[model samples]
Target: MTAARTPLYEEHVRLGAQMTNFGGWVMPLQYSTIREEHHAVREAVGLFDLSHMGELRIGDETLVQRVLSRDVTRLRPGRIQYAVLCNDAGGIIDDVLVYAMPDRGYLLVVNAGNQDGDFDWIRKHAQAADAARNVGREWALIGVQGPRAVDLVQRLTPSDLASVKYYAFVDGTVADVSCVISRTGYTGEDGFELFCGNADAVRLWRALLEEGRSDGIRPAGLGARDTLRLEAGMRLYGNDMDAQTNPLEAGLDWTLNLEKDFIGRDAIMTSRQRGLARQLVGFKMLDRSIPRHGYRIVSDGEGVGTVTSGNVSFTLGYNIGMAYVPPAMSEPGTRLGVDIRGAAAPAEVVPLPFYKRPHPK
Candidate 1:
């Protein structure tokens, strides 16, 4: 299958970015270097083209409440909540952001790769045939992340950004382009994610880059995005968890509201009563090897679990990764080993989110 190009494709080429195929879309891997981009977001700011993410517009409140793990009725308009979509068997289908629009409908921002499958699954369970609409291709998502992100965007808009609390959104204009200015991000930083029309993507992208030049803003890509998210202790869909993985074992129990009746609630309750065999936990390398996905995790010379996500944390100057291990071995400071080419590279289980942004004064 041919990979689709985003509206910023030409701009990425013009900037000489390294392009790679991600989730059926050709996206920038890095503009200059992954380390540089990573540091830019940590210290200053970085812009991203997130057009490949899927957007589903659903008008049926009943369908929304049935599928989402969180109680959507409590999600007020202009606010967003992070939740997961689960199957009847208590396995996660996808992790998504539920945005309650002012118009009383809901917008689900899902992973690019699972967009089609998610649409099919939701539509299959919808009370009305036209309750869900796939609007991903018609929109573009641009993420401006970092310490200076809010200020950089404030210059281009007349909206009161100060009042736009985190996880909240407002319909406004930026660079004279209409947008749904949302205060949310993946990089564990203070930032805003701007949603605009596909035609306005290039313009919005260029305007942000130009305006942020003085603030040490750089166009970041998937490579930097991965490391930043890892340091922030954020989970990637396919890497951290999947259709076969339950949210309970993934340390996402907070996303589930057992009080409300929803899809997979019964199975999830059953799993809770039955007990989990393994759990996901964070670990840092004690030896000099970098952990990679699918690496075997060992304890007492036995293969115990598998590494899900691993990388060299640029900010901390250490190797960090996440893996699923037995409940007994999941605590911080528990010693373990990562099998690296027949060698047991020593590692220690640690609390997640190796890095956290300092609070603003």
Candidate 2:
């Protein structure tokens, strides 16, 4: 079967991006270099095509509650909430962002690879009166990330950008195209994600690039995006957690609202009662070696766990990673070793988010 291509496929090729298949979609892996694009997002601004992500519109509050891990009804219009979709077994199906639209409806932005599965899961549980629409293919999502993102995006829209606080959104016209602009991003930076129709994607992308030319806005790709998110300590669905991993062990307790009865609450409670066997923790390499997925983690000269996500933080110039280890060995300041290619490399557990952006005055 042939892989699908996003609306920005031709545009990426024209811009000389190196393309690769991601979640069955042909996407840009890098434009120039991963390090350069990664630094651009940290120092200036970077544009990303997140059109591959799935968007679902669910109108029923009761149905939303049953499918989400958080209190979706508590979110007022124009706000956004981060939550996870759990299976009956209490394992995560996907980590999603819920947007409370001005129309009193909810928009869910889900993982690209899990789009079909998530849709099927939601539909199967949805009541006959409940309505859920797959809007992923109908809209293109553009992520403008960094400190300068707001300034550049504000120029193209009449909406008061500053009025839209973090995790909030507004409906407005951007460069003559109607869109939903949200003050949210995955790179742990102050940025805006513009949701526009597929027909206007190229135009909006080019317009943002032209408007932000002086601000060092570069077209970034998946490679830089992965590194940026890893530096921020964000969990990737397939790697960090899956159907077998629960929220409590993945360090995502904040996203779970067990007070409200949702799917998997019982299983989650069961896991809590049984005690967590392991927990996800962040670490920095003490030796000159890079960590990779599936690398064995050793504590006291015995295999304790394995690395889920690992990378050399281009911005920090240090090798950092996250691994699932026994809860006893997951605390900060704990010493451990990563078996990199059969050689044990010393590492130390550290607080998550190896990189943190400076707060604006």
Best by TM-score: 1
Local distance difference test, each candidate: 0.95, 0.92
Candidate 1: where is the Cα deviation over 4 Å? none
Per-model TM values vs. the true structure: 0.99, 0.98
Clashes of 2: 0
Pick the lDDT winner.
1
lDDT tens readout by residue for model 2, 1-361: 6888888889999999999988878899999999999999999999999999999999888888999999987899999999999999999999999998778889999998999899889999888634888999999999999989988998889999989999999999888889999998889889999999999999999999999899999999999999999999999999999999999999999998999999999999999999999999999999879999899998667889999999999888899999999999988999989998777899999999888899841
What's the distance in Å from true for residue 232, model 2? 0.5
Which residue runs of candidate 2 sit more than 4 Å off their true CA positions? none
Q: Please give the range of 10 consecutive residues that has the lowest summed lDDT in model 2.
A: 125-134
- Residue 229 CA error for candidate 1 (Å)? 0.5
